[model samples]
Target: MTTVAFIGLGAMGYRMAAHLPQHFDSVLVWNRNVDKAKQHAAEFNTQAVTLAEAAQADIIFSCLPTSHQVDEIIHQVDIKSGAIWIDCTSGVPDIARTQATYLKSKNVSFLDAPVSGQTIGAENATLTFMVGGDAEVFDKALPAMQALGKLIKHVGGSGAGFAVKAVNNMLLAVHLCAAAEGFTTLKAHGVNLNEALDCINASSGKSGVTENVLSQRIFNRSFPNTFALLLLAKDTGIALDLVRDAKLSAPVIALSQSLIQAASATSDADSDFSAAVKMYESWSKITLE
Candidate 1:
Protein backbone atom coordinates (compact mmCIF):
# COMPACT_ATOMS: atom_id res chain seq x y z
CA MET A 1 0.00 0.00 0.00
CA THR A 2 1.34 3.45 -0.90
CA THR A 3 1.88 5.80 1.99
CA VAL A 4 1.62 9.58 1.99
CA ALA A 5 2.15 12.19 4.71
CA PHE A 6 0.38 15.54 4.74
CA ILE A 7 1.45 18.53 6.81
CA GLY A 8 -0.64 21.62 7.66
CA LEU A 9 -4.30 20.86 8.34
CA GLY A 10 -5.66 24.35 7.91
CA ALA A 11 -8.73 25.29 5.81
CA MET A 12 -7.58 24.06 2.42
CA GLY A 13 -5.00 21.60 3.72
CA TYR A 14 -7.54 19.70 5.79
CA ARG A 15 -9.81 19.03 2.83
CA MET A 16 -6.91 18.26 0.50
CA ALA A 17 -5.43 15.83 3.02
CA ALA A 18 -8.76 14.02 3.46
CA HIS A 19 -8.69 12.91 -0.17
CA LEU A 20 -5.24 11.38 0.16
CA PRO A 21 -6.44 8.43 2.27
CA GLN A 22 -9.03 7.57 -0.37
CA HIS A 23 -6.24 7.02 -2.89
CA PHE A 24 -3.37 5.81 -0.71
CA ASP A 25 -3.61 2.89 1.67
CA SER A 26 -1.94 4.68 4.56
CA VAL A 27 -2.17 8.42 5.04
CA LEU A 28 -0.38 10.16 7.90
CA VAL A 29 -0.96 13.74 8.96
CA TRP A 30 0.92 16.31 11.04
CA ASN A 31 0.19 19.88 12.08
CA ARG A 32 1.76 22.51 14.29
CA ASN A 33 -1.40 22.27 16.30
CA VAL A 34 -1.57 18.66 17.38
CA ASP A 35 -5.30 18.82 18.10
CA LYS A 36 -6.12 19.85 14.54
CA ALA A 37 -3.97 17.02 13.22
CA LYS A 38 -5.68 14.55 15.53
CA GLN A 39 -9.08 15.85 14.50
CA HIS A 40 -8.26 15.39 10.84
CA ALA A 41 -6.95 11.87 11.47
CA ALA A 42 -10.14 10.92 13.27
CA GLU A 43 -12.34 12.49 10.64
CA PHE A 44 -10.47 10.83 7.78
CA ASN A 45 -9.72 7.56 9.58
CA THR A 46 -6.02 8.13 9.15
CA GLN A 47 -3.07 8.29 11.51
CA ALA A 48 -1.85 11.42 13.27
CA VAL A 49 1.85 11.17 13.64
CA THR A 50 4.88 13.28 14.50
CA LEU A 51 6.65 15.12 11.73
CA ALA A 52 9.54 12.67 11.92
CA GLU A 53 7.25 9.68 11.51
CA ALA A 54 5.11 11.31 8.84
CA ALA A 55 8.15 12.26 6.81
CA GLN A 56 8.93 8.58 6.23
CA ALA A 57 6.04 8.24 3.78
CA ASP A 58 6.55 7.71 0.05
CA ILE A 59 5.39 11.27 -0.52
CA ILE A 60 5.29 14.32 1.77
CA PHE A 61 2.88 17.13 1.02
CA SER A 62 3.09 20.50 2.76
CA CYS A 63 0.57 23.32 2.56
CA LEU A 64 2.10 25.84 4.91
CA PRO A 65 1.34 29.56 5.15
CA THR A 66 4.69 31.00 4.15
CA SER A 67 8.16 30.18 2.88
CA HIS A 68 9.51 30.46 6.42
CA GLN A 69 7.15 27.75 7.64
CA VAL A 70 8.16 25.49 4.74
CA ASP A 71 11.78 26.04 5.65
CA GLU A 72 11.11 25.13 9.26
CA ILE A 73 9.31 21.93 8.27
CA ILE A 74 12.07 20.83 5.91
CA HIS A 75 14.70 21.49 8.52
CA GLN A 76 12.87 19.84 11.41
CA VAL A 77 11.42 16.79 9.67
CA ASP A 78 13.26 13.59 8.85
CA ILE A 79 12.20 12.80 5.32
CA LYS A 80 13.58 9.55 3.93
CA SER A 81 15.30 9.05 0.60
CA GLY A 82 13.21 8.72 -2.57
CA ALA A 83 10.25 10.56 -1.03
CA ILE A 84 8.67 13.23 -3.13
CA TRP A 85 8.11 16.64 -1.49
CA ILE A 86 5.17 18.53 -2.90
CA ASP A 87 4.66 22.11 -1.73
CA CYS A 88 1.12 23.46 -1.97
CA THR A 89 2.06 26.77 -0.32
CA SER A 90 2.13 30.04 -2.23
CA GLY A 91 5.71 31.11 -1.57
CA VAL A 92 8.51 32.96 -3.23
CA PRO A 93 9.87 31.27 -6.35
CA ASP A 94 13.51 31.72 -5.34
CA ILE A 95 12.80 30.08 -2.00
CA ALA A 96 11.01 27.25 -3.79
CA ARG A 97 14.06 26.75 -6.00
CA THR A 98 16.36 26.77 -3.00
CA GLN A 99 14.23 24.21 -1.18
CA ALA A 100 14.04 22.04 -4.30
CA THR A 101 17.79 21.93 -4.53
CA TYR A 102 18.18 21.19 -0.82
CA LEU A 103 15.65 18.34 -0.99
CA LYS A 104 17.19 16.92 -4.14
CA SER A 105 20.53 16.66 -2.38
CA LYS A 106 18.86 14.23 -0.01
CA ASN A 107 17.50 12.22 -2.96
CA VAL A 108 14.01 13.63 -2.48
CA SER A 109 12.37 15.21 -5.50
CA PHE A 110 10.48 18.47 -4.97
CA LEU A 111 7.52 19.99 -6.78
CA ASP A 112 5.89 23.38 -6.24
CA ALA A 113 2.14 22.94 -6.79
CA PRO A 114 0.35 26.08 -5.61
CA VAL A 115 -3.41 25.88 -5.95
CA SER A 116 -5.84 28.55 -7.39
CA GLY A 117 -9.18 27.92 -5.72
CA GLN A 118 -10.45 28.76 -2.24
CA THR A 119 -12.26 26.99 0.63
CA ILE A 120 -15.47 26.37 -1.31
CA GLY A 121 -13.50 25.07 -4.25
CA ALA A 122 -11.50 22.78 -1.98
CA GLU A 123 -14.67 21.38 -0.44
CA ASN A 124 -16.06 20.88 -3.94
CA ALA A 125 -12.78 19.34 -5.12
CA THR A 126 -12.48 21.79 -7.99
CA LEU A 127 -9.27 23.70 -7.35
CA THR A 128 -6.78 24.44 -10.11
CA PHE A 129 -3.20 23.27 -9.42
CA MET A 130 -0.23 24.93 -11.11
CA VAL A 131 2.79 22.65 -10.78
CA GLY A 132 6.48 23.32 -11.38
CA GLY A 133 9.02 20.52 -11.37
CA ASP A 134 10.23 17.69 -13.51
CA ALA A 135 7.55 16.41 -15.89
CA GLU A 136 8.12 12.89 -14.57
CA VAL A 137 7.60 14.01 -10.97
CA PHE A 138 4.40 15.81 -11.93
CA ASP A 139 3.19 12.72 -13.81
CA LYS A 140 3.86 10.55 -10.77
CA ALA A 141 1.79 12.79 -8.54
CA LEU A 142 -1.10 13.40 -10.97
CA PRO A 143 -3.39 10.75 -9.55
CA ALA A 144 -3.04 11.99 -5.99
CA MET A 145 -3.46 15.61 -7.04
CA GLN A 146 -6.53 14.67 -9.09
CA ALA A 147 -8.32 13.57 -5.94
CA LEU A 148 -8.17 17.15 -4.57
CA GLY A 149 -8.34 19.34 -7.69
CA LYS A 150 -10.10 19.52 -11.06
CA LEU A 151 -7.33 21.15 -13.11
CA ILE A 152 -3.62 20.34 -12.82
CA LYS A 153 -1.00 21.67 -15.19
CA HIS A 154 2.77 21.58 -15.24
CA VAL A 155 3.62 25.22 -15.87
CA GLY A 156 7.40 24.82 -16.07
CA GLY A 157 10.52 23.60 -14.25
CA SER A 158 11.46 24.23 -10.61
CA GLY A 159 9.89 27.37 -9.11
CA ALA A 160 7.73 28.00 -12.17
CA GLY A 161 4.57 26.98 -10.36
CA PHE A 162 5.05 29.72 -7.81
CA ALA A 163 5.98 32.16 -10.58
CA VAL A 164 2.76 31.44 -12.40
CA LYS A 165 0.81 31.47 -9.15
CA ALA A 166 2.23 34.87 -8.20
CA VAL A 167 1.39 36.33 -11.60
CA ASN A 168 -2.09 34.82 -11.54
CA ASN A 169 -2.79 36.15 -8.06
CA MET A 170 -1.41 39.61 -8.88
CA LEU A 171 -3.94 39.88 -11.68
CA LEU A 172 -6.64 38.51 -9.40
CA ALA A 173 -5.84 41.22 -6.87
CA VAL A 174 -6.17 43.90 -9.53
CA HIS A 175 -9.42 42.47 -10.85
CA LEU A 176 -10.89 42.18 -7.36
CA CYS A 177 -9.95 45.75 -6.44
CA ALA A 178 -11.42 47.00 -9.72
CA ALA A 179 -14.65 45.11 -9.10
CA ALA A 180 -14.93 46.33 -5.53
CA GLU A 181 -14.21 49.95 -6.45
CA GLY A 182 -16.71 49.84 -9.30
CA PHE A 183 -19.37 48.32 -7.07
CA THR A 184 -18.73 50.83 -4.35
CA THR A 185 -18.91 53.70 -6.85
CA LEU A 186 -22.17 52.39 -8.25
CA LYS A 187 -23.63 51.95 -4.78
CA ALA A 188 -22.61 55.48 -3.84
CA HIS A 189 -24.58 56.72 -6.87
CA GLY A 190 -27.70 54.90 -5.58
CA VAL A 191 -27.31 51.84 -7.81
CA ASN A 192 -28.60 48.55 -6.44
CA LEU A 193 -25.60 46.32 -5.82
CA ASN A 194 -27.32 43.08 -6.80
CA GLU A 195 -28.55 44.47 -10.11
CA ALA A 196 -25.17 46.04 -10.85
CA LEU A 197 -23.44 42.74 -10.04
CA ASP A 198 -25.82 40.96 -12.42
CA CYS A 199 -24.97 43.40 -15.18
CA ILE A 200 -21.24 43.12 -14.48
CA ASN A 201 -21.42 39.35 -14.61
CA ALA A 202 -23.07 39.52 -17.99
CA SER A 203 -20.71 42.16 -19.33
CA SER A 204 -17.05 42.00 -20.38
CA GLY A 205 -16.23 43.61 -17.03
CA LYS A 206 -16.66 40.22 -15.35
CA SER A 207 -13.67 38.32 -13.94
CA GLY A 208 -13.09 35.50 -11.49
CA VAL A 209 -13.11 38.09 -8.71
CA THR A 210 -16.43 39.55 -9.87
CA GLU A 211 -18.18 36.30 -10.80
CA ASN A 212 -16.87 33.86 -8.19
CA VAL A 213 -15.78 35.80 -5.09
CA LEU A 214 -17.15 39.35 -5.06
CA SER A 215 -20.71 38.66 -6.23
CA GLN A 216 -21.07 35.32 -4.49
CA ARG A 217 -19.37 35.96 -1.17
CA ILE A 218 -18.90 39.70 -0.51
CA PHE A 219 -22.32 41.02 -1.55
CA ASN A 220 -24.03 38.05 0.08
CA ARG A 221 -21.85 38.42 3.21
CA SER A 222 -21.14 34.70 3.16
CA PHE A 223 -17.35 35.13 3.69
CA PRO A 224 -17.09 31.32 3.26
CA ASN A 225 -13.61 31.21 4.87
CA THR A 226 -11.73 31.42 1.61
CA PHE A 227 -8.13 32.64 1.48
CA ALA A 228 -7.60 35.53 3.89
CA LEU A 229 -6.67 39.12 3.01
CA LEU A 230 -3.44 38.89 5.01
CA LEU A 231 -2.36 35.95 2.89
CA LEU A 232 -3.40 37.73 -0.27
CA ALA A 233 -1.31 40.72 0.73
CA LYS A 234 1.64 38.44 1.30
CA ASP A 235 1.17 37.02 -2.19
CA THR A 236 0.95 40.53 -3.60
CA GLY A 237 4.20 41.35 -1.90
CA ILE A 238 5.75 38.24 -3.44
CA ALA A 239 4.50 39.29 -6.87
CA LEU A 240 5.83 42.79 -6.36
CA ASP A 241 9.21 41.39 -5.39
CA LEU A 242 9.23 39.22 -8.49
CA VAL A 243 8.51 42.18 -10.73
CA ARG A 244 11.08 44.29 -8.91
CA ASP A 245 13.68 41.58 -9.28
CA ALA A 246 13.00 41.34 -12.99
CA LYS A 247 13.10 45.14 -13.31
CA LEU A 248 9.68 44.96 -14.98
CA SER A 249 7.25 47.88 -14.92
CA ALA A 250 3.80 47.17 -13.52
CA PRO A 251 2.13 50.32 -12.29
CA VAL A 252 -1.33 48.75 -11.95
CA ILE A 253 -0.03 45.87 -9.84
CA ALA A 254 1.82 48.34 -7.67
CA LEU A 255 -1.41 50.24 -7.07
CA SER A 256 -3.26 47.02 -6.33
CA GLN A 257 -0.51 46.00 -3.93
CA SER A 258 -0.94 49.25 -2.01
CA LEU A 259 -4.68 48.62 -1.75
CA ILE A 260 -4.13 45.09 -0.51
CA GLN A 261 -1.49 46.30 1.95
CA ALA A 262 -3.90 48.90 3.33
CA ALA A 263 -6.61 46.24 3.67
CA SER A 264 -4.20 43.90 5.40
CA ALA A 265 -3.48 46.58 8.00
CA THR A 266 -7.13 46.76 9.02
CA SER A 267 -8.98 44.28 11.28
CA ASP A 268 -10.50 42.77 8.14
CA ALA A 269 -7.20 41.17 7.18
CA ASP A 270 -8.46 37.99 8.77
CA SER A 271 -11.47 38.16 6.50
CA ASP A 272 -11.51 37.21 2.80
CA PHE A 273 -9.56 39.18 0.19
CA SER A 274 -12.81 40.63 -1.16
CA ALA A 275 -12.85 42.56 2.09
CA ALA A 276 -10.59 45.02 0.33
CA VAL A 277 -13.84 46.63 -0.70
CA LYS A 278 -14.21 47.60 2.92
CA MET A 279 -11.00 49.59 2.68
CA TYR A 280 -12.44 51.69 -0.11
CA GLU A 281 -15.62 52.04 1.92
CA SER A 282 -13.67 53.34 4.89
CA TRP A 283 -11.82 55.79 2.70
CA SER A 284 -14.98 57.09 1.03
CA LYS A 285 -16.96 57.08 4.31
CA ILE A 286 -19.56 54.93 2.58
CA THR A 287 -20.75 51.76 4.24
CA LEU A 288 -21.07 48.82 1.85
CA GLU A 289 -23.84 47.37 3.93
Candidate 2:
Protein backbone atom coordinates (compact mmCIF):
# COMPACT_ATOMS: atom_id res chain seq x y z
CA MET A 1 0.00 0.00 0.00
CA THR A 2 1.27 3.45 -0.81
CA THR A 3 1.55 5.67 2.25
CA VAL A 4 2.72 9.25 2.52
CA ALA A 5 3.52 11.14 5.72
CA PHE A 6 3.42 14.92 5.88
CA ILE A 7 5.34 16.73 8.60
CA GLY A 8 4.68 20.30 9.74
CA LEU A 9 1.14 21.74 9.61
CA GLY A 10 1.53 25.46 9.64
CA ALA A 11 -0.56 27.67 7.32
CA MET A 12 1.21 26.44 4.18
CA GLY A 13 1.80 22.88 5.35
CA TYR A 14 -1.78 22.39 6.48
CA ARG A 15 -3.11 23.30 3.06
CA MET A 16 -0.33 21.49 1.19
CA ALA A 17 -0.94 18.29 3.16
CA ALA A 18 -4.63 18.43 2.35
CA HIS A 19 -3.82 17.51 -1.24
CA LEU A 20 -1.80 14.36 -0.39
CA PRO A 21 -4.74 12.13 0.61
CA GLN A 22 -6.04 12.04 -2.96
CA HIS A 23 -2.68 10.83 -4.35
CA PHE A 24 -1.72 8.15 -1.82
CA ASP A 25 -3.52 5.13 -0.45
CA SER A 26 -2.87 6.33 3.09
CA VAL A 27 -1.94 9.77 4.40
CA LEU A 28 -0.24 10.45 7.73
CA VAL A 29 0.28 13.90 9.19
CA TRP A 30 2.48 15.09 12.07
CA ASN A 31 3.05 18.48 13.62
CA ARG A 32 4.88 19.83 16.65
CA ASN A 33 1.46 20.87 17.86
CA VAL A 34 -0.20 17.47 18.20
CA ASP A 35 -3.63 19.05 18.23
CA LYS A 36 -3.11 20.61 14.79
CA ALA A 37 -2.32 17.23 13.32
CA LYS A 38 -5.35 15.68 14.99
CA GLN A 39 -7.50 18.52 13.70
CA HIS A 40 -6.21 18.07 10.16
CA ALA A 41 -6.86 14.33 10.30
CA ALA A 42 -10.36 14.86 11.58
CA GLU A 43 -11.15 17.33 8.83
CA PHE A 44 -9.46 15.45 5.98
CA ASN A 45 -10.19 11.83 7.02
CA THR A 46 -6.48 10.98 7.34
CA GLN A 47 -4.42 9.56 10.20
CA ALA A 48 -2.36 11.66 12.56
CA VAL A 49 0.92 10.06 13.64
CA THR A 50 3.83 10.85 15.91
CA LEU A 51 7.13 11.97 14.37
CA ALA A 52 8.67 8.51 14.68
CA GLU A 53 5.55 6.85 13.37
CA ALA A 54 5.61 9.24 10.42
CA ALA A 55 9.03 7.96 9.43
CA GLN A 56 7.57 4.63 8.33
CA ALA A 57 5.70 5.99 5.36
CA ASP A 58 6.79 5.30 1.77
CA ILE A 59 7.14 9.01 1.08
CA ILE A 60 7.88 11.69 3.65
CA PHE A 61 7.10 15.40 3.10
CA SER A 62 8.08 18.33 5.28
CA CYS A 63 7.12 22.02 5.09
CA LEU A 64 8.82 23.55 8.08
CA PRO A 65 9.82 27.12 9.08
CA THR A 66 13.54 26.74 8.45
CA SER A 67 16.27 24.26 7.53
CA HIS A 68 17.25 24.14 11.20
CA GLN A 69 13.85 22.68 12.13
CA VAL A 70 14.14 20.33 9.16
CA ASP A 71 17.52 19.21 10.47
CA GLU A 72 16.08 18.54 13.90
CA ILE A 73 13.20 16.48 12.48
CA ILE A 74 15.54 14.32 10.38
CA HIS A 75 17.54 13.19 13.44
CA GLN A 76 14.52 12.63 15.69
CA VAL A 77 12.78 10.22 13.34
CA ASP A 78 14.36 6.93 12.29
CA ILE A 79 13.22 7.07 8.70
CA LYS A 80 12.81 3.77 6.89
CA SER A 81 15.24 2.76 4.14
CA GLY A 82 14.40 3.60 0.50
CA ALA A 83 11.77 6.13 1.58
CA ILE A 84 12.00 9.48 -0.16
CA TRP A 85 12.04 12.71 1.83
CA ILE A 86 10.78 15.89 0.13
CA ASP A 87 11.56 19.11 1.98
CA CYS A 88 9.61 22.28 1.11
CA THR A 89 11.23 24.54 3.62
CA SER A 90 12.81 27.88 2.60
CA GLY A 91 16.14 26.60 3.80
CA VAL A 92 19.87 27.09 3.53
CA PRO A 93 21.65 25.43 0.58
CA ASP A 94 24.57 24.15 2.67
CA ILE A 95 22.22 22.59 5.21
CA ALA A 96 20.29 20.95 2.37
CA ARG A 97 23.50 19.43 0.97
CA THR A 98 24.43 18.05 4.41
CA GLN A 99 20.96 16.57 4.87
CA ALA A 100 21.12 14.98 1.43
CA THR A 101 24.48 13.35 2.23
CA TYR A 102 23.32 12.05 5.60
CA LEU A 103 20.11 10.62 4.15
CA LYS A 104 22.06 9.05 1.27
CA SER A 105 24.22 7.07 3.67
CA LYS A 106 21.04 5.35 4.91
CA ASN A 107 19.85 4.41 1.39
CA VAL A 108 17.00 6.93 1.49
CA SER A 109 16.57 9.60 -1.15
CA PHE A 110 16.38 13.33 -0.35
CA LEU A 111 15.16 16.29 -2.39
CA ASP A 112 15.23 19.96 -1.57
CA ALA A 113 12.02 21.11 -3.24
CA PRO A 114 11.16 24.51 -1.85
CA VAL A 115 7.95 26.07 -3.18
CA SER A 116 6.60 29.47 -4.19
CA GLY A 117 3.10 31.02 -4.74
CA GLN A 118 2.45 31.55 -1.02
CA THR A 119 -0.50 30.39 1.11
CA ILE A 120 -3.23 31.09 -1.41
CA GLY A 121 -1.42 28.96 -3.97
CA ALA A 122 -0.89 26.24 -1.39
CA GLU A 123 -4.60 26.18 -0.72
CA ASN A 124 -5.34 25.82 -4.41
CA ALA A 125 -2.61 23.20 -4.99
CA THR A 126 -1.04 25.51 -7.57
CA LEU A 127 2.33 26.24 -6.06
CA THR A 128 5.58 26.23 -8.06
CA PHE A 129 8.30 23.88 -6.89
CA MET A 130 12.05 24.41 -7.44
CA VAL A 131 13.43 20.93 -6.90
CA GLY A 132 17.06 19.82 -6.59
CA GLY A 133 18.15 16.20 -6.44
CA ASP A 134 19.06 13.26 -8.64
CA ALA A 135 17.26 13.56 -11.97
CA GLU A 136 16.08 9.96 -11.89
CA VAL A 137 14.68 10.30 -8.37
CA PHE A 138 12.83 13.47 -9.42
CA ASP A 139 11.27 11.58 -12.30
CA LYS A 140 10.20 8.86 -9.86
CA ALA A 141 8.65 11.41 -7.52
CA LEU A 142 6.93 13.48 -10.24
CA PRO A 143 3.58 11.71 -10.02
CA ALA A 144 3.34 12.24 -6.29
CA MET A 145 4.52 15.85 -6.49
CA GLN A 146 1.91 16.64 -9.15
CA ALA A 147 -0.69 16.34 -6.42
CA LEU A 148 0.73 19.39 -4.65
CA GLY A 149 2.07 21.77 -7.29
CA LYS A 150 1.07 22.93 -10.73
CA LEU A 151 4.65 23.58 -11.86
CA ILE A 152 7.65 21.53 -10.72
CA LYS A 153 11.10 22.01 -12.23
CA HIS A 154 14.24 20.08 -11.43
CA VAL A 155 16.59 23.07 -11.03
CA GLY A 156 19.90 21.25 -10.43
CA GLY A 157 21.58 18.87 -7.98
CA SER A 158 21.58 18.70 -4.17
CA GLY A 159 21.22 22.26 -2.75
CA ALA A 160 20.36 24.18 -5.88
CA GLY A 161 16.68 24.50 -5.06
CA PHE A 162 17.34 26.16 -1.72
CA ALA A 163 19.90 28.44 -3.32
CA VAL A 164 17.36 29.62 -5.88
CA LYS A 165 14.66 30.14 -3.26
CA ALA A 166 16.99 32.17 -1.03
CA VAL A 167 18.03 34.38 -3.93
CA ASN A 168 14.39 34.76 -4.96
CA ASN A 169 13.43 36.09 -1.56
CA MET A 170 16.49 38.31 -1.50
CA LEU A 171 15.37 39.87 -4.78
CA LEU A 172 11.90 40.33 -3.34
CA ALA A 173 13.50 42.17 -0.44
CA VAL A 174 15.34 44.44 -2.85
CA HIS A 175 12.17 45.23 -4.76
CA LEU A 176 10.19 46.01 -1.64
CA CYS A 177 12.95 48.21 -0.19
CA ALA A 178 13.51 50.08 -3.44
CA ALA A 179 9.80 50.65 -3.89
CA ALA A 180 9.38 51.91 -0.35
CA GLU A 181 12.21 54.42 -0.76
CA GLY A 182 11.12 55.57 -4.23
CA PHE A 183 7.44 55.96 -3.34
CA THR A 184 8.31 57.80 -0.17
CA THR A 185 10.48 60.18 -2.13
CA LEU A 186 7.71 60.75 -4.69
CA LYS A 187 5.15 61.39 -1.97
CA ALA A 188 7.56 63.80 -0.29
CA HIS A 189 8.04 65.74 -3.52
CA GLY A 190 4.30 66.55 -3.87
CA VAL A 191 3.48 63.74 -6.33
CA ASN A 192 0.27 61.78 -5.79
CA LEU A 193 1.15 58.28 -4.59
CA ASN A 194 -1.50 56.46 -6.63
CA GLU A 195 -0.69 58.30 -9.85
CA ALA A 196 3.02 57.67 -9.43
CA LEU A 197 2.30 53.98 -8.92
CA ASP A 198 0.12 54.03 -12.03
CA CYS A 199 2.93 55.54 -14.10
CA ILE A 200 5.50 53.16 -12.65
CA ASN A 201 3.25 50.20 -13.27
CA ALA A 202 3.05 51.14 -16.94
CA SER A 203 6.75 51.96 -17.20
CA SER A 204 9.97 50.00 -16.71
CA GLY A 205 9.86 50.45 -12.92
CA LYS A 206 6.82 48.20 -12.50
CA SER A 207 6.97 44.96 -10.55
CA GLY A 208 4.75 42.69 -8.49
CA VAL A 209 5.33 45.10 -5.64
CA THR A 210 4.03 48.13 -7.52
CA GLU A 211 1.20 46.35 -9.26
CA ASN A 212 -0.19 44.33 -6.35
CA VAL A 213 1.44 45.08 -3.00
CA LEU A 214 1.21 48.86 -3.39
CA SER A 215 -2.47 48.79 -4.32
CA GLN A 216 -3.92 46.00 -2.18
CA ARG A 217 -1.93 46.40 1.02
CA ILE A 218 0.12 49.58 1.32
CA PHE A 219 -2.22 52.14 -0.20
CA ASN A 220 -5.21 50.57 1.52
CA ARG A 221 -3.24 50.79 4.77
CA SER A 222 -4.45 47.32 5.63
CA PHE A 223 -1.09 45.55 6.01
CA PRO A 224 -2.83 42.26 6.69
CA ASN A 225 -0.51 39.42 7.65
CA THR A 226 -0.29 37.65 4.31
CA PHE A 227 3.42 36.90 4.74
CA ALA A 228 5.25 37.55 7.95
CA LEU A 229 8.00 40.16 8.12
CA LEU A 230 10.07 37.96 10.38
CA LEU A 231 10.10 35.13 7.84
CA LEU A 232 11.15 37.43 4.98
CA ALA A 233 13.92 38.80 7.19
CA LYS A 234 15.05 35.26 7.89
CA ASP A 235 15.08 34.37 4.19
CA THR A 236 17.02 37.53 3.37
CA GLY A 237 19.59 36.58 5.96
CA ILE A 238 19.88 33.10 4.42
CA ALA A 239 20.47 34.70 1.00
CA LEU A 240 23.13 36.99 2.40
CA ASP A 241 24.81 33.96 3.99
CA LEU A 242 24.78 32.20 0.63
CA VAL A 243 26.38 35.25 -1.01
CA ARG A 244 29.07 35.51 1.70
CA ASP A 245 29.80 31.81 1.27
CA ALA A 246 30.48 32.42 -2.43
CA LYS A 247 32.88 35.26 -1.59
CA LEU A 248 30.71 37.76 -3.47
CA SER A 249 29.64 41.26 -2.54
CA ALA A 250 26.00 42.38 -2.75
CA PRO A 251 25.72 45.93 -1.46
CA VAL A 252 22.05 46.43 -2.35
CA ILE A 253 21.06 43.12 -0.80
CA ALA A 254 23.19 43.98 2.21
CA LEU A 255 21.35 47.27 2.65
CA SER A 256 17.99 45.62 2.02
CA GLN A 257 18.74 43.00 4.65
CA SER A 258 19.61 45.68 7.19
CA LEU A 259 16.35 47.51 6.42
CA ILE A 260 14.25 44.32 6.67
CA GLN A 261 15.98 43.36 9.92
CA ALA A 262 15.33 46.81 11.33
CA ALA A 263 11.71 46.71 10.13
CA SER A 264 11.24 43.30 11.77
CA ALA A 265 12.31 44.80 15.06
CA THR A 266 9.45 47.31 14.95
CA SER A 267 6.67 44.74 15.15
CA ASP A 268 5.81 41.25 16.37
CA ALA A 269 7.00 38.20 14.48
CA ASP A 270 3.57 37.68 12.95
CA SER A 271 3.21 41.20 11.54
CA ASP A 272 2.63 41.53 7.81
CA PHE A 273 5.72 41.89 5.59
CA SER A 274 4.22 44.93 3.84
CA ALA A 275 4.40 46.78 7.15
CA ALA A 276 8.09 47.16 6.33
CA VAL A 277 7.25 50.13 4.13
CA LYS A 278 6.14 51.95 7.23
CA MET A 279 9.78 52.25 8.24
CA TYR A 280 10.41 54.41 5.18
CA GLU A 281 7.23 56.33 5.87
CA SER A 282 8.39 57.11 9.37
CA TRP A 283 11.79 58.22 8.10
CA SER A 284 10.47 60.46 5.31
CA LYS A 285 7.39 61.63 7.23
CA ILE A 286 5.16 60.54 4.36
CA THR A 287 2.65 57.71 3.96
CA LEU A 288 2.13 55.76 0.76
CA GLU A 289 -1.59 56.38 0.91
Pick the lDDT winner.
2
How many clashes in each structure? 0, 0
- Please write out the lDDT profile of model 2 over residues 130-180, one tens digit for every residue: 999999989988877899999999999999999889888888889999999
Query: Across residues 127-189, which tens digit of lDDT does each residue of candidate 1 receive?
Result: 899999999999988888898899999999998999899888889899988877787788889
The residue-level lDDT of candidate 2 at 21 comes to 85
- Give the TM-score comparing model 2 with the true structure, all chains together: 0.96
The lowest-lDDT stretch of 10 consecutive residues in candidate 1 is 267-276
Off by over 4 Å in 2: none
**Backbone clashes counted, model 2:** 0
Local error of candidate 2 at 244, Å?
Answer: 1.4
Please give the TM-score that candidate 1 achieves against the real structure. 0.96
Candidate 1 residue 121 C-alpha distance from true site, Å: 1.9
